[model samples]
Target: MSYELKSAGALSGGTCCYAGSRLPVRGPKRDLDSPYIAFLGGTEVFGRFVKTPLSDVSESLLKMPCVNFAGVNAGLDTFASDQALQSVARSSEISVLQLLGAQNISNRYYRVHPRRNDRFLQAQPPLKELFPEVDYTEFHFNKHLLSSLQARSEERFAEVRRHLQEVWITRMQEVITTLEGRVLMLWVRYDLKGSAAFNHEPVLVDRSMVSALLGSTMGLVEVDVATAGIEGDFDGMIMGELDFPAAQHMLGPKEHARIGCALAEKLQGLI
Candidate 1:
C-alpha cells in the first residue's frame, strides 16, 4: 500500500439535516433526492481531521452520492436510536456501516448519552453489581471506565467484555434490520491491541464479532491499517494544532485514499 499525504489544512464544512431529522451531519450536504449511498459510523466516518473522508473519495471514484451521517464519538446506539437518521439510511440505495466499539452503547451494565455514545452517563445496577468495590460515579467516558475496570481485575473485566460484545452483536443486527438497503459493513482495524485492550479503536470487538454480522449484511470489507504501519504513525492530516494529538491516531489522507478505494471497489461490484 502507498503511504502519502494528499493535503493538510483546516476543514470548512456545511452542516446537513433531513426532514424530521435533527442530527448534525458533516457537509456540504448532498441532494438526497438522487440515488446515493449513506455512510454511517463514528469518528472515522466523520473524518474528524481529514479533509476528504473516505465517503467523499468513494463518491468521486464511483460517480455516486454518498451521504455522511457519521458523528464524532458516535456508537451503534447513536444511529440505532435515531428515527430520522434511520429513515434516511433506509431510503438510501446502499448503506455503509462502520464497525464501532461495543463499549460506547448502553446495556445492562451502563447507560450512555443517546447521540454521543462515547460519554458515559451512569452505571447500571449490573455494572455496579459486578464491580461493587469500585465507584462508577468517577467516570465520564466509556473507554476510561472500561480501562479502569480492567485494571481493577482482569477476571472480573472479562464478564463486562462478554456483555458488551453480546450487546454489540444484538444491536448491530437490529440496526441492519432497519437499514432496508444493500448494507456493506466496513471493518477498519488500524492496529493490533497492546496491553490496554479496551483502549483500542473499536474497543472490545474482534474480527469474529464483526464477521458474525456478515450474515445480516450484504458484505464486509476489512482494512488492516496496522499491517501498513499507518495506524498511529500517519501524516498529511488536516487539523488545528490543538486537535493534532487526537488526529494523530486517525487515518491520514493517504490512508483515507486507500480505504476509499477499497470501499469503492466493493460498492462498485454491488452496483
Candidate 2:
C-alpha cells in the first residue's frame, strides 16, 4: 500500500499537514542485529507530497531497519522539543540528519504563541516581533512575514538569526554527540538548480555552522537531485512521476524511488 496523504482540512494534531503514510517502524519487526537507521528533518524528510517515503528507499536498499522521524512543518525548535529526536537518540544505530533551509528558524517562533513559547524563545521579544503580522487564530509560522522582517531590518534580523542558528547548531551537536553510532548528514531540499524549475529559486546552502558541528565526526552525503536533471513523463519540479495532487512537497514517485535508491547506496557504503 502507498503512504497516506493528509491534507489541510484533515486532523493535524497541532502539526503541519503533509503527505506520507504512517508506516510501522521497521526496527521492532526486524532482528536485534538489524542496524537501526533514523530519518530526520521536516516534511521533506517525511516525504511530504511524495507518494513513497525516503524510509521506504532506505529499507529497500540497505536492508537495515529504518524509522522516519520527520515531522510536518518541523523546524529546529520543533525537532528539539519533539519526541522523535529522543526516539532517535534512544532507538537508532545511525541517523540521517537532513538539515532544511534557514526559514525554519523563523518558524520556530512564529508558529507557536507566547503562552506556548519555550523559555529560550520567550526571552527574546524582538525576535517574536519579526512575525507580528501573523494571525495566531490557527497558528502558522509566517515565512513571508519573517522574510519581510529580514528584508526590513537586516541588522536586527542578523542578530536574531544568529541566535536561532546557534540554537539549531547546538541542539544538533547535542544529538550527534550523544548518538551511540554513525550519523550521516543528509542535506535535502527542492530543486535549486537550472533556471528555477516551476518557480523554484536557487538557494545557497550556508554550511559553515554545519561544518563546525560535524568537525570530522559525521559522514556527509549531499543529494542534489533537484539539479540532477531527471526529466519525468510529466513536467514539474521533480519529474512528473510523483503521485501528488499538489507539487509542494518533493520529487514525484519515480524521483522518490531514485532518491531511495541513492540513499540506500550511500548507506550501504557506510555500513
Candidate 3:
C-alpha cells in the first residue's frame, strides 16, 4: 500500500522507484522523468526480495534504463483503473504489462473485502465476499477438497470461469487501448501449492485476448512462458505458500533475478 522512491542517480543519474510493504529500496532515485524501460506486473513483477529489483534487470540484460510500476497484491482490475492508466500514460519510453490468471481477475469483479487507503486499492471487492450466497469455495479452488474435480466439471466450474474470463478480456482490451509507446503483456500464472493450479487455461485465455487487442494496436509485444510448466522442478520460483520468507505473494531474491532477467530479454527486443 505504501511506496518509497529510491534513485540510482549516482550511477545512471536516473531514478528508480521501489515500493510495497517491505524490503523497500534505499539505493536509487526512480527516474520518473527520463525515458525508461518500464515493467508492469503483479507481485511477482514487483519482485518481493529481488536484490537488484526488476527495474535493474535491464542494466544487466540490455544495458538500458528501466523502472517498475508493479503494485503489490495488484490484479488486472488495478491496472485498468484511471490512476494506474494515467501513471502508464505519463511516464516511461516503453511499457511491459503482465496479465495475471483469469481466476485472479474473477476475484476482483465482486466486492469481498474492505477498502484500504493505498495506491493499489481499487474500488472493487473480492468475488467471494460479494456473493456470499454463492459458494466461494468453488471459486477458490486452492482451499476446497473437491477443487480439482469441481474445476474439471464442465457444467459448474467452466460456466463461472467463462463469465470471469469475459471480464478479464474486457479489461485487457482497455489496457491495450490506453497505454502509449511499445507495450508488452507477460502472462504470469497463479502458482497454487507449487503447482500449475489453473493449468494453461487462464494463460490461453490471456494470450488469445491479448492477441485480439494487439490486432487493433501496433506496439503490443507478447511474452510467452508466463506460466511455468508445473511438472518441472518448482522448488524456488513458486509464488504462493509459506516456504517463502514472508508474504505468499512472492519468492526469494534469486527467483526474482531470474524472472527479471528473463523479462528483460523480452522487453529488450521491443525497446
Best by TM-score: 1
**lDDT per residue as tens, model 3, 185-204:** 66544444445444442333
Using Cα atoms with residue i matched to residue i, what is each candidate's TM-score against the true structure?
0.90, 0.65, 0.61
- Worst-scoring 10-residue span by lDDT in model 2: 114-123
Assess candidate 2 and give its TM-score to the true structure. Answer: 0.65
What is the full ranking by lDDT, best candidate first? 1, 2, 3
Candidate 3 wrong stretches, greater than 4 Å: 1-29, 82-85, 88-90, 106-109, 112-154, 189-206, 216-262
- Please list the C-alpha lDDT of all candidates, in the order they appear: 0.80, 0.52, 0.49
Clashes of 1: 0
33-104 per-residue lDDT for model 2 (tens digits): 455777766555665444456776778777777766666555454545545355543566777877654444
Give the best candidate by lDDT. 1
For residues 1-80, could you state the per-residue lDDT of candidate 1 as single tens digits? 22233233346564566656666677776778998899998878887766788899999999999889988787899888
